[model samples]
Every structure is written in structure tokens, then in C-alpha cells.
Target: MKQGIHPDYHEVVFLDSATGYKFLSGSTKTSSETIEWEDGKTYPLIRVEISCDSHPFYTGKQKFTQADGRVDRFNKKYGFTK
Candidate 1:
């Protein structure tokens, strides 16, 4: 890796807003917010709307909707005929 040419990669905390789940990981993303991790260290805080912790599939709360083709859905929605 070349120096001064690549973005700074450092540890950052990703927060799932819905579930308040947090995990530390490396990223090039930067943020003004900071958070104290479980290790007693501070890291940049990044807030996200959805994560695996709160996602329906991961939580086993996913709904199995009847799969509808695009044409069928469009026609049904607009009442298209002929």
C-alpha cells in the first residue's frame, strides 16, 4: 500500500438505530460523532437505519408475501385491459 494516496482506514462503530446494536469495524468513512466501546476505547460513530440485528430475515420475522409478476402487479394496480 502506498502512503498518502489512500484514504485513512481506522476503526469505527456502526450503530443500528432501530435496535441500538453496535459493532466495531474498520472503515474509510468518517464521522463527527464518537462512541465509547466496550473495550474502553473511543471510535467514530456511524448511525444506520437497518442492520442484521434488526432486519426481518435475520430476526426470523420476515413475511413471505405472494410473489407477483411485474406485469400482473402493474395491470392490477392500474386496471389495464386489452
Candidate 2:
């Protein structure tokens, strides 16, 4: 590791907006936002659109959809060819 050439790494709070789930981890990502954590300390806050808390695969709610628009043979099999 080199000194004075690396980005500042520190603890950060990642928030899942959809579920309001928050977890602590280290990151080099910087944010102007901050939040008071459950431990009564504040860290850099970053909001994400999706996280494991609300992701479909992690929640076992993923929809199994057939790929239906790219192949002519697939369309024919589904009686969508004209």
C-alpha cells in the first residue's frame, strides 16, 4: 500500500430506499448527506435504488418471464408469428 496516493476510506451507511433498510460498511464513496445510525453515531449516507432488502431475487419473488421478443423461432413457438 502506498501513502498519500489513495482515496480516503471510511465507514459509510448504505440505505435501501424501497425498504428503509440500512447497513454499515466501508466505502470510498463520498456523499454530502448524513444520517444518525442506530448506534447514535453519524456516518456518510448513500441511498441506493435497490438492495438485497427489496430485490426480487433475494426475496424469492423474482418473476420467471420467458424471453419473448428476440427470436423468430421463439415467436413462432408461441404462435406470435404472423
Task: Identify the candidate with maximal lDDT.
Answer: 1
C-alpha lDDT of candidate 1 relative to the true structure: 0.91
Pairs that collide, model 1: none
Q: What TM-score, to 2 decimals, does candidate 2 have?
A: 0.73
| lDDT for each residue of candidate 1 in 1-82, tens digit (9 for 90 to 100) | 7889999899999999999999999999989999999999999999999999999989999755545466678888899975
Q: lDDT, candidate 2, residue 12?
A: 95
lDDT of each: 0.91, 0.89
lDDT tens digits, residue span 6-68, model 2 = 999999999999999999999999899999988999999999999999999899998645443
- Work out the TM-score per prediction: 0.71, 0.73
lDDT of 2 at 27: 96
Clash count for each candidate, listed in order shown: 0, 0
